[model samples]
Each structure stands twice: as structure tokens, then as C-alpha cells.
Target: MPTATIAEDDDGIRLDRWFQRHTKDISFNIVSRWSKSGVVRLDGAKAGPGDRIAAGQTLTWPEELPVPVATRPTEKPREPLSEAQIEYMRAMVLHMDAHAIVINKPPGLATQGGTKQPTSVDAMLDALQFDAPSRPRLVHRLDKDTSGVLLLARNAKAAAFFSKEFAGREARKSYWALTVGVPKIAAGTIDAPIGKQPGTGGEKMQVDTEAGLKAKTRYRVIERAAGRAAWVEFLPLTGRTHQIRVHAAAIGHSLVGDGKYGGKESYLTGGISRKLHLHSRRLVIATPGGGTLDVKAELPPHMAESWQMLGFDLQLGDIEIVEPPPPPLKKRRLSSATSGNRRGERRSRGATDEPKRPPRKK
Candidate 1:
């Protein structure tokens, strides 16, 4: 019998899920058959396929069963990366530590692969595994057209921790965008619920107040350009698919170059590139052990050009709003003597300090 101990990362997961993750050669039917035949045991006791697994628990199976060859369609083998491709991935690394890697993802680069997308950051992760025990895992994804501040976990433990933080909405993220028009309300929250649009095969999202997932975004206008475009900062309070884009379009101020959501109105008249202008500017999240991870990414080329064309100040720093704004500066209290003296002066100036009596004769 070959016995394996469950790791903490696999704690509380179903036995079938554990098998799927660790033993890829073995199918669920084989696991179920072995469990029924008493060939699969957990800590010397017969176990079923649906049983939950715990950390440090021993799982044993009979060695007589031969590993079956996969009959499912195999994926196309990935070609090796050239030296130039390796350097390209390395150059995108904005911040790298023991547990995390933050990259400045460029516009038009897909975070993960799709049927249409062949080259993606996920495919190139092997190039990023420098001195690490395994290739980095993606904790979250950036839209293929949107760029900036994509985080990667270096190992399984870090991946689990980061994934939980993002799922719980504990991670704070800020995005910079150039909207087609200035928002009527300069700074406010968008509390529109979002849902996938019908007939689009869930490829597009829309604001469906009646039946949609809760999606909220806080936005502030950093600057406006002659009533044409505005530089805005958006903080998503709740993560939803295409939340920012949908909310922005819902408010009638779609993002510049966001033709899918904004339609013809999304395009600007200037020489700006039609690529999406949304960028994940900053991210703040707690690390695995103790401290916090804060990172910021610079504006991509097309956005930088548009900013310059609009005469926007590049020196203006980011408005940090991860935490709540500090309380307003306290006002100095007036001393009692000073207050009295002011009242006396008002009286001398013919402003009566007491209420006037009316209609005494009546």
C-alpha cells in the first residue's frame, strides 16, 4: 500500500477533490471502486470517496491497481520560451518578495489564456519561477484590455492566503481611468447591482437593479479636461465581473476607449489610442505572515500620451484612500474671557445681547 499524508492546504476538502488535485492519473470511478472494495483506507479505517480529509491524516490505497491512461482529450503541449520571452516576463516584475510577485501588466496582454488568447501571463509563469520551489500562481486576474498591478503568489501557502483575502474583500484595490465625460457628481459611490447581459453568452455585464449581484464602487474625479474627459480614481467596494466598467457606463460616463460597454461614445476625438484606459493603479493586501503589501504601477504608454495631450499634471501623486480619510482638522476652542470680550464688543457696536420686549403697553 502507498500512503500519503494530507497537507494543511488540502484541509477540509472532500476526498475526491484531494484525489483530483494530487493523483491526476486516477479517475473518480477508480477512487469510488477502490473505496467500495475496501482498498482505500484512511488511517487504517475504510474511507469513502465523499469523506472529508483533514491535515496530517493518512490516506492509503492498494498498490495493485494500475494507474489508468487518460482517455480525455489532451491539451496542446506548451512550447519552450526563448531568451527574449524570458526577459520580457522578467521586465514586467514590479515588486518581488519571498511570498508575492507584483507585475505591471501591459495593455492587450491577457492575464490568463482563453480560446482566442494563445499568449498570456499564466502561460509565461514558468519564466517567473526564479529560485522558487514552484511556478507562481495567479490569485486574481486583470481584464485582458485593462492593465497594471497584477499580483502572483509564489507558493501554495501564499496562494491560499491571497485567494482568501481577495474572496473576503479584505484586499483593497484602486484603478485609474479616463472617462469620456466628467461625472455629474464629482465624488460619490455607485451602488448598482450587476448581472450578465442576456443573449451575450455571459460575455458582457450590465446593471440589473432588480435581479443582480451587489456591486459597489467609490469614484473621485482627480481632474477634468475642458468638459471633455476626466481622470478618475475608482475603488471597488465589492468585486464583480466588469463592475467598474458597467457602473461607469451606467452613470453615462463610460471609460475612454471602452467601446464594448460605452459604444460609439467611448471613443475620444483626439489622437489617443483606442485601447482601454482602465489601469489597476494600486493594490494593498495583508501578506501571509504579518505585514502588509502595498504596490503601485505607473501609467501605460497610451494613457501617458493622453494625459500629456490634455495638459494634465503628471506630478500630482495618487490620492491614497485605502483607509478612511482622517477626521477634519480640529478647530481651536475660544477661551471664556475672549468670548465674553467679543460679546461686550458686539454690545458696544449696538448689537443687543438680550432679547427685546414687545408690546409692553398692550
Candidate 2:
């Protein structure tokens, strides 16, 4: 991100107004959201959109922040979205409607921004608004480097509706990845619990079996390259952070190039790129109003390149889907009649007694 130093002439400008004046694409709504979401910082502290700026104050924001509200652009012609960027965003759309939008997001793009994150999908939502008044909101997240289908809610109604589905565990999301080693089993369920790793300043996670939230993932090895690596498909039953990656690592088949959990072996030799080899391949869920939303994303560039290099088939995960776990059984009590007994009778004395202690032997 680049830093903007407030000049003496532009002192006392509201953060929101500054964006409106300088940037052609950064709307007031985007400014407001960015401020409230902690993506805007003033002198290393979270800033509000209404905050006033003075001379020498430094404002840091995502490098991709749309055109300037700075003094240099107040009298200049408006800058339009570059043709290349417009085309890139247009090509990522898999499906779009009044209620939602499904996009095949690329790798290395953060779903949400943080202190060091200068650009992210959330920051670029303005390009997708089209006829809508407000920007589409993210329903869920994929990891920063894990590319593939990302769902967004186009309006507030859609946002609430999809959020409920995600909360209720209704979204059937499937992911594909290349892992370092082959699993002994071809397919299985991982029922371990996971939670934030202790004392890593809240930056990492672990298999906290002792006191962790429940997380389960069902995986099937779609294709394997012997012991060198395996291409696995995952259906996670829970929404814990880094659940799939951590579970795969715990099972001794860490994803290739995933160092946070995969360790040193994540880096492979022989011309394979050292990038996280995970992609959210598909999503099946109910739409906000009353229909189904099924979308699939193709392999991202790096993964596709790796697929070609390793001789792995890229079309194997086209229709990947897994059945949800069955519901738990209910307990029932038996009545006296059901137990082969009269209502008021007990077992016979002889039947209830030992066999006379074997005639007092020994």
C-alpha cells in the first residue's frame, strides 16, 4: 500500500469526502465500508470515514484504491477503469443475478483485507455492482492463496439469506488440492476438532483435540501420482478456519506448498510451483429467493500448469459432490411387556439365583 501525506491546503477534509473528491471509482459507500471494516488506517491506527485529516498526517490504504480524492485530481478529467482490469473482472464472473454473484477468484488474492493486505476481492467489489446501489457483500471466505468459486450477496436481502444458509451448514462446497503424499485410504472422514493455535498471536491454527471446536472433512483421492503426490477432493462439513489444510496435514498428506501446516515437504522439486495447491472447485446451495445455485470453477493457472507438468487429469473434479452425514439416532425405552415380563411380576427366584454355588465346591 502507498502512503498519502496530507498537504496543508487539503487539511480538515473528511476521510469520506477526500475519497469522493480524488477518486473517480471509489464511491462514498466504498469509503464508508472501508473505514468501518478497518481497512483504512491513519498513522497506523484504524480510522473512521468521518475523521478529519490535517497537514502531515499519513493515510495508508490498499494500493488498488480507486482514483484519487487528492488535490491533484480535483480539476482533472476522471480516470476510467482500465480496459484490462475491466476485462479481467468481467471474465471472472461465473454467474450473476439480483440476489447473488458467483465468481472464480484467482489465487494469491485475499478475500478480505488486513493491515498489510493492500488489495483483495472485497476491495474490488465495486466493479461488480452493475445496476445495484450498494456493493455485493461476501458470504464466506476462501484462503488468501486458495483460488476458486467465491460467492457474494448482491443485496442486503440476499446477504441475510445466504448468511443463514452458511450458518446452518447448508452450502455444499467442494475443493480440490494436490498434497505431498498419498493416503493409505482412498477415501475417509476426518472427525478431529480444530481451533486457533495457542500463543501465535492469533495468526495460526492447530488440531486442538483437547479443547477445540468440532470440524469434520470428507476426502476422496480423485487421482494420485504414486507416493510423490495425490490430487484430493475435499468436502468439509464444518467451517473452521484452515480446516481442510490442517486436517490434510494432520493426516500426513499436507497440501503441496502449504508451509503453515504442511512443513518442509510442502515445497516440491522438479519444476512444480511453490504455491498453495487448493481450489474451491464447486458450490451447491439454495439461492436467496427459492432456487438452486450450482457453479464450478476450473483450475487456476498455477494449478493447471502443475497438472500439465505432473500428467494429472484436470477434468476429474468437474462434478465432485459428497453426501452429507446422516442424522444421529434417537434413544427409546422399552416397556415391561416389550421386555417379556408381566406388569407386576419380577424374574423367578431360581432364574435369578446362582446354581447353588456348584454344590459348595471349593
Candidate 3:
């Protein structure tokens, strides 16, 4: 058996990737087989194939004969659908069409499942009973905390076409974010190169000029309140994981309620009305039908409430300023002359009137 201690830079890497780095002789196929047989334990428990291996996790891999392919199941059968699962299936159907389905994903739900839990966007789709033999497929993904427009393809051909469009950078996505402070500039572009942070649970993205992928974002200040938050529109030119969040934070204006990227103040003070103030507001894509497809999602309740509290009119693009209170006045120090002047009258009254004679002896 080979043992490895997870490092800080390895946070968001897959279990297979971790094993590949540590055990030079082990093949990915063998590791996959071991994962299926429950030979690899992450943090003292069985880990799945897609589980992100974070730092501080203890990984143990057994070195043994390859498990028989016949013995190992190809894929686990879907579990019995629960009431909640059924409801999700029903909701998914509402978004279905001939070619694609668009979903209004809520916040706090992961697009894909990890080792510990199975309730994810993909799992739910797997459990769904479609009339045809084909299974639903994800065309794109959203962050766990960001709620809004998500697209899925119904068939393999459709999935392939959409994948091509995404890879070719033909898809256009827009987002609405409430930031902590008003940006000085009204409209500008953030041209930054984004690269994944090594070993930090794989959750962090950093700005790298030399080696990072090129990312471009066009931002316009929709509304700004002096000394408070601002509502902004974002258009990402390239899709890098957490690209928008990291770029915004790099400019010293983190999305409101984004705790991981220095958004604690906005979160705690209820600056923007939600746990995370960013939302996927709109998506425009070149449809398979030779036309454009535009979809928009309404603002979530939390974001709406916060906007109201800050006296913002989304439709009109107006905002009210609630400036922070001014700092207290500092006490002024008195000079030595001023202090002596105040006591000068008393000292003069006690002055002697007689003239003094010169001293003869020293």
C-alpha cells in the first residue's frame, strides 16, 4: 500500500489525479478499479471517482492484482426515486424541449455530486425517467452558490453540437452582481489571465500573467451608491472557473457575500441581501436552428430584497447613496505659549515692585 498526505495545493484535484502524482507505477485504470472496490479511503472513508481531494486528507491506496473487469460493475444502478426526487424530475421536465432544456438552479446545490452525497444536478437527471432511451446530459455548469440559468442537452448529438459551440467561444453568458463598494469607473474591461491555484483544495483561482489562460470580462456599473454597494453587469469573454469572482476580487471589489474571496464584511453586514449576491441573469446562445436563443432569469428573493433595502430600482437603473458616518473629530493639542497665556494674569499679579541692588560678592 502507498500512503500520501494531501498538500494545500492539492485541494480541488480528483482522487485519480492525486494517486497518479504519488504512485508513479500505478495506472489510472488500476486506480479506477481500486476506487470501485473501495480500496482507497479518503479521510478514513471510501471515496468516489469524482470526489475532489483536498489538502490534509489521508489517502491510502492498496498495491495488488488488478480487480477483474467482470467482477467490477460498470456503473451503479440508480436508486429508487424519493418524493423529492420525483418533484425534481417533474421540474426538470418543465424545462425540456426538442433539443435542449434550461433549468433555474437554486443556490447551494452542486452541479455534480461528490463522494459523500448523491443529490446533485447530474444525479437527479440520471434518476429522471425519460420516455426515450437516452439520458440527459449537462452542456454547461454553474458554481454551487450561484443560482440561475443552466443548460442541458437531451441527446448525444445535441450535446456534441453545444459542446462545440462552447469550445469555440460562440456562447454568450451574462451575470448580475451586487458588489461591496461602488467602482470608480463606470464601464471598463478586466483583461486578466486566470490559472488554477495548486493544492488549495482546487477551489481557488489566481491571476497569472505568464502561464494563465486568457480571460476577458466587460463590466458596466448599473447603479452605485457612494460608500456602499453597487449593482453591476458582467459579460465574460472566456469561461475560466471562478474567473469573474477572482477578477472582481483582484480589483478590490469582491462580489457581495462571497466569503471565500474576502467578502466577509458584505456577508455579515447584510450589504447585499443574499448569502451570495451574484446571479446568472441571462444567457444568449446561437441556437442549433440558425438563430439566437436568449433566456433570462428573474432576480432571486434574497437579491431582490437587498436591492430594495439599498434603495435600488433595477428597471430604472437608479440607486440611492447611504454614506457611512464621518469619523469623530480629533482633540487639538495646546501649545506651550497658549498654556502660559492662560496663567499669565495670575503670575503678573504676584510680581515684586521693589528694585533689586547689584550683588557685591560672588
Ranking by lDDT: 1, 2, 3
In model 2, where is the ten-residue run with the lowest total lDDT?
349-358
On lDDT, the stronger of 1 and 2 is 1
Q: How does each model score on lDDT?
A: 0.81, 0.77, 0.69
Using TM-score as the yardstick, the better of models 1 and 2 is 1
- Over 4 Å off in model 2, which ranges? 1-84, 319-362
Cα displacement (angstroms), candidate 2, residue 218, comes to: 0.5
Q: Higher-TM-score candidate among 2 and 3?
A: 2
Residue 35, candidate 1: how far off, in angstroms? 9.3
How well does candidate 2 score on lDDT at residue 190?
75
Candidate 1 Cα errors over 4 Å, as ranges: 4-16, 24-59, 64-76, 315-317, 322-362
Instruction: Return the TM-score for each candidate structure.
Output: 0.77, 0.67, 0.64
Candidate 2 residue-wise lDDT, 1-362, digit = tens: 76788764345667776666666677778767878788888888888878877668888877776535444454634245566766777789999988888999999888998898957787777788788765688989998999999999886557767888999999999998999977666666677788888888767888887888998887777777767988888889899999999888877788998999987889999989899999999999999568999999999988998888888766565543334453344532344321433111122211321111112346
- The prediction achieving the highest TM-score against the true structure is 1
User: TM-score of the candidate numbered 3?
Assistant: 0.64
> Relative to the unseen true structure, what is the C-alpha lDDT of residue 169 in candidate 2, on a scale of 0 to 100?
96
In candidate 3, the residue pairs with backbone N, CA or C atoms under 3 Å apart (3 or more residues apart, or in different chains) clash, namely 8-199, 9-198, 9-199, 9-200, 10-199, 11-199, 11-201, 11-202, 12-201, 12-202
Residue-level lDDT of model 1, residues 1-362, one tens digit each, is: 77788776566667876777766567788889999899898888989888877778998887765432232235456688989989999999999999899999999999999789989999999899999866799999999999999999987668878999999999999999999988756665677788999999999998887799988887777778978998888889898999889988887889999999999989998697788999999999999879999999999999999988998775443744333453355843344422423111111111222212223465
